[model samples]
Target: MKDHTGKPVYFDEEFREISLMLLKAKTRWQIDQLKQYADEAIIFIDEPILSALGSSSYLGVSETETARLLKELIDVIKNEGGISGIHCCGNADWPMAIKCGPDIINFDAYDYAGTLALYPEEFRGFLEKGGYLAWGIVPTSEAIAGENPESIRKRFEQGVEKLSLHIPKDLILSNIMLTPSCGTGTRTVEETIKVFQLLMRLKEEYA
Candidate 1:
């Protein structure tokens, strides 16, 4: 939707057209997911640019407006009885995503978890309201080669502790899901396989 015109639609520029097209296409995608998954699928709306919310590139766009745009897309998934997960794996304006009311807030917990800890009150409110947290604990970078299950698990523990400042650990854990720090499209096949295995082993250990 951002490239509906064969060129990028700058958020600081005229983005209303791109926004509308995205909303329509997103709603259609949700409808298709419901038809295919029949309520069992958690439809993810991937908008990586959202991480740029507070940057100079998006200076013309207000945080409130960003939340409104996200809500417009997220509501499509929620209305269909599907869990809506919004991911911005980079250090983003966490409060904006939280304000959008996604069932899950997926962030780069491996590196930028502390950025989220800054919003203890808002995150506590989100968690207290039964929102889920998709902690991207496993490394997706070349560091994946050096990381093992124990190290990854320790990172998760530290992140959860930072996040659990105002919320109960049990509540946070109950709603948590582990994932890579970002998508594995850029990773090697063998590396991706190892990433999965490491996390699975960690899960069994915790289980």
Candidate 2:
């Protein structure tokens, strides 16, 4: 993935797009623009395609190269004295994310906690290196139907139990941040507020 993002986009076997390398220069240029309006201390890179890393359509893509591309963007945030966090929001390659050495890895832990549970060693290494986990444990969809702060906390406990097998419970809890499964792109304003409310309550309960 080099920075020259041009005219048309390309796709891989599963029909996922792997086109766009995210060059270091473009990252620096773009982040410099964002710094004017947002806090530059915690610049997050949202790369949905990171989830398509090893998919059929992306077979030609080398994992090492992909990590390099990710590191390029991360280095930009770091150079700016910012914490670089990447959000995939899917059950993608966790090890790849860790190898890139991001300060935080955000994922849809609501449904994919088990997916991460499979990579205990890598997960531990990432945490040990001071990498934090923004566990998206709150559901943003209709699955939120019967859930409240209390119920979601229980769900979180069950999920964290899997990760705690390889890492300590206190360590996992200390480095965790809660988030919704994904953005409420189509949710009503009231529903969106409810997500935030649940998050607040969960924070209090856990705190």
Candidate 3:
């Protein structure tokens, strides 16, 4: 229905005229413009097509169509030498996402760690094809934000243990990324800062 790119755009039903690739192109242009004033950092574009695919509004489109759109957008970003990530916090079309060419797959690993782990064939295929798993382990809510790094680290380790059934420890570490369970936009600014500081401390200890 609406563009999920965190912009101020309020789209009407008429806005469905735009294709997803065009949306990615416009967003990429905006990112390029912002790069001049921001610090150097990896850029990720959230298309949310998979989430859309599962919605009633998008029921008219086939999975293949959505995947094709995602593939085209990912190719454009890859050609521009940009790191690309797709965030699908809810249930997603993972097999489709893997083939669509996202370098990073951001998912709720803290809760659904076993879902991916048990799917050995799919998980192995994704790993072999060079897709990294951005595990959403750190909680972002005010209530869960008070968790200590040790507890978070242990949760991550446990996830590793489960994932080890399909992948080796070294291989998992190479492709693993730790992230907040979700965006902190719903939380207070203080909680967001705390998440950053906690992550920094983990980096120092792990690095």
Most accurate candidate by lDDT? 1
Best-to-worst TM-score order: 1, 2, 3
After superposing candidate 3, which stretches have Cα over 4 Å from the reference? 2-17, 34-41, 47-58
* Candidate 1 local lDDT, 88-188, one digit each (tens): 87878777788888999888889998887788788888888989888888888999999997898888899888877867889888888887888898999
lDDT of 2 by residue, 14-56 (tens): 2222333435556677677877877766656787777887789
- State which candidate, 2 or 3, has the greater TM-score: 2
**Model number with the top TM-score:** 1
Scored by lDDT, model 3 comes in at: 0.71
Error of 2 at 7 (Å): 7.7
Q: Estimate each model's TM-score.
A: 0.86, 0.82, 0.79
Clashes of each: 0, 5, 0
Candidate 1 whole-model C-alpha lDDT, 0 to 1: 0.80
Local error of candidate 3 at residue 90 (angstroms): 2.4
Question: Of the pair 1 and 3, which is ahead by lDDT?
Answer: 1
What are the Cα lDDT values of the candidates?
0.80, 0.78, 0.71
